[model samples]
Target: MTAIIHDAVIVTGDDEDTVHYGASIAIDGTRIAAIGPNAELQQRYPSAERIDGRGRMVMPGFANTHTHLTMTLARGVFEDLSPPHKPPFSGGLSPIPLPDMTQDERRVMAQLGALECLRSGVTFMLEDSSDIDDYAETLAGSGLRFLFGERAYDRTGTAIGDPAPFQLDRAMGEKHMATIERTFAKWNGKADGRIRIAISAWAPDMCSPELLKDLSALQSKLGTWITIHLNQIWGEVAAVQAHRNRLPTEYLADLGFLNDKVICAHCRCMDPREEKLLGDAKVIVAFNAAIAARRGLSPRIDSLERQGCTITMGSDNMAEDMVEVMRTGLFMERVRREDGRNPTPEQALRWASRNGYKAFGMADGGWLAAGNKADLIVIDTQRAHLVPMLRAVSNFVHNGQARDVQSVMVDGRWLMRDGKVLTMDEPAIVAQAQEVANKAWSRQFKKRFDKPPAGFSPAALP
Candidate 1:
């Protein structure tokens, strides 16, 4: 089947990167066939089905390099927990006692999160899964392209409410490995080669050195990608330095785990030496700006980028809004550099889109060009913030929101059209997810506390 998107502003992913004023994109099967002026493409593919892209800007959808799909329930649930806002895993008081949610609850929440990603112009994601078996069905049904990172941990007594203690044991670790292998066999190259599995290790503190080494070896054996959080907080930095007598990056590098296939999230505390190590190892650094800002941590984006390090963007905690991430990224860098013009919108877009694909060892998607994957999003140009657009891409990075996204296509299929999802029933998914999360949070909070805090009424959630 052939389809041509006509009379649109095409942002071709080229080094010169000139926007085609009235171009058309022809898709043959799942790959882009041609990108040129509308007249040229129309004459080229005369009989193809046409999509009128008038009054719209078509660009490659953003790649969310790191995300916890099931963490959607935690959104806005723990905002004011403590001073500096203690995370659920921390020993400090938690705003809401995150209850033990079942696999079914996670699936419902994950489905809602997936739909949110599509609506926000995110076509690809590197999603971390707790139990691959439980959510495999939900992931399979999600039309969005993603990489499932099977998470593992072996250390115990590290933090409060940590899942690592429950996941410890060499036998249990091997069982998790078996699940990953089975998942890869069944899902890798499935859904028309849009989904693949990666081996994920929890942070160094949560996982022992032996577990990290074993997981690294397993990743190599399976030819899969590896992901881990590195230097997310000062406390983690202190612990790693105290235990290993080196920085977090140095410890990971010493394990022979630093490589191009490895993605290290939140290198906010990395210095020049560690930055160079990451650059030399060709490691992909996920700069999760939204979460970093919320936690009062920020990465040195320009410094790392200039040092030959490749950086990508991730929403991290379920702030699934890409525009928020981009804006936060721009502001974070500007604030750090004390130079408002240091990181431009173009650079921010590159991190959010192209760099994310490069991080995952996929080169075909993340840009609008011939022969790339047909994963692109369309933004309505008529919105108030989008009006008077002298520069289209800049306006998109700076002013556009998720609601501005009109349609989205992944693997030549419309996952969302006219702001409505086609593959999943979004309203039903959201309702079920809200119900389960509310019940879970309420029960957990009640059990953890004798009396609720002042002004905290046990009201029903939306």
Candidate 2:
């Protein structure tokens, strides 16, 4: 598969933040073969398929460091339901529980999430869940790169943020281990190295010390990556403190689970000492900025980066819009710093693209280079909101919408072209997923609420 997109603006999200105008990128097989002026690329690749790029800006696609793909089912319901940050913590992120779905239903919802990711120009994802195999095959067929982390934990009788007494569930932990191993065997290094696998510790409050140590050992033994939810909420922090008499980061540190290969998601509610501890470990922080804003929290991205942490961006739960994540991270950091010019758009794009791709162990991706992987997106820059494009990178970063994404390519294959999805049936996926979510919510509300509350109207379910 050889192709050339000629006469486009290229935003190479490299360390130098180079932007090339009137340039062309030549893709050969699964790698970028050449980048040069339009005539030069045309002359070089004479037999390649040509794509007009006069009104588009081509850049690296996003690599989301952390997200739960099936959480797309809770989109309209969960964003408005956040747990209290004070004492007497709630069990999980929301007081209202989500309706459970069958494996097939979950597969549909995961497809919906994948649709959103492709539409929003996400090429890579790290899915954190206890059971990824349920929808693993379905997502693999989507042609996007992924790093799957199958979770294992020992504590029972409580959800993520509950302060209940820890009950060791050794059998359940072993069950998770078996599933993790099975999933790894089935999918790790699959798709010709387009997909990778990882070991996941659910959370410090949810996993016992023995289980954490075991997970760490397994990660080392397998020579794989590790990921965890670290200090996501104050309730989880309180729960960890009560359970171990130490902060969540301290617990992981004591168990020797903190390392450079570990991708820590949501360090929003950590103490300054704990933050410093994570930075000292040189961990990568998946700064899920949009979800943090929904919960009215934010991570200390600057301080963490300064203290030696590699900062990356994630869409997290209930969303898959990396454009929103990148822009929101920029706005949040600017407001936090009270200085608008500190972390530039280039830096934010690096966190969203380059840093995340590096964290996913794809150093050859998320940037524009002659020999790098051909993973990139084309944005339609002829829209009204994108005009006056003196600063192309800043214009796209600050004001770009997901709808601006016109084409997406991963491994030199087009997953989306000119607003049409190529991998999955978008209409069928969306229709089935809408029914799945509607029925799930209807069932939950019917189970919990006897009558509709004021200002609440349930959807008419099939």
Candidate 3:
């Protein structure tokens, strides 16, 4: 079927960063067939389905390159806690443990995350998590493009910044490797290539040297994408120094794991030397700004970009809104470099869209072009806050809310239209997620303590 979204402001996130005031995008099957002046395209595809794009801004959908979708359950619980970063390092990234959930409940939570992504105009994402097989089908059914990373780590450290002894659980490592292979075989290229698989070692401090070597070899053998948390916190940095006698980037390099196919998330604690090393390797850095700011940290994004590393944005934990991620990224970088004029909204938009797609190996996506994939979003510009849209992209970046998203199209199909998700039951998913999260947190607190954290309250289970 052919459809034409006509008569809107088109923000072509192409190499030239083109913008069209009254343009139309013609979608033929799963690819954009044409893009040009609205009247011209309307005549060109006269018989196609016409989607009135009046008072809307059509742009390539945002790509969230790094996030843990299932961690949506921890939204209110973990955001306020600050993990220790001092000499007496803690064993984990957070004090609260991950709440336990049944497989069905986990599926509901994953779908809830997908719902938020759709509502917020994210068409693509890279999700790094353990046991992705549990909700792979659920995510696929949500009609969003995904790269699922089957995470594996042998270290028994409870949290990410654990300075405990690194025990080599070879058997467990092998089992995880097998799980990765199985997950890839089962889910890679599923949903007509909308779903892909990747390799993930949870963190530098959580994986042993031998396991890293094996994972690198496996990555090369399979020729798949790899992602890992790198130098996320000061404790993690100190732990790696104590164990490997080298920085995290150097350790990954020694294991032959720092390369273009790898995406390093949360490089917030890196030094200039490590930045140079990562840049030399040409790896993509997932500059997860929202979570970084919540954790009271920010990466040297400008320096990393200057060093030839591609800067992509991710929502990380607790949230899946790429809009928030993009804006936060811009603000954080400006504050970090003390240059408000540099790293403009246009650059931040590219990082959130184009760079993210490139990191996930989608060469023709995350941009609006004739030959590019038809993964885009339409934001209603008729809202009061979005009025006087003198500068479309800049205004959208600084003032737009997720509620302004009017439609989401993926692979030439409207996954969401007129602010309604067509692929899943949104209200049902949200209600179920709330119920499941309450029970899960209640179970965790009852199993461990009588009181919840300060300023935190889990909904009482009925």
- Best lDDT among the predictions, by candidate number: 2
Score candidate 3 by lDDT. 0.89
Q: Provide the overall lDDT of each model, using Cα atoms, as 2-decimal numbers.
A: 0.78, 0.89, 0.89
lDDT of 3 by residue, 325-408 (tens): 898988988888889787888999999999899888898999999889999999999999999888898999989988999899
**Distance from true position, residue 239, model 2, in Å?**
0.5
The positional error of residue 189 in candidate 1, measured at the CA in angstroms, is 2.4
Per-model TM-score, in order, reads 0.92, 0.97, 0.98
Query: How many angstroms is residue 388 displaced in model 1 relative to the true structure, after the best TM-score fit?
Result: 0.9
Off by over 4 Å in 2: 450-457, 460-462
C-alpha lDDT (0 to 100) for residue 138 of candidate 2: 88
Query: What's the ranking of the predictions by lDDT, best on top?
Result: 2, 3, 1
Model 1 TM-score (2 dp): 0.92
The count of residue-pair clashes in candidate 2 stands at: 0
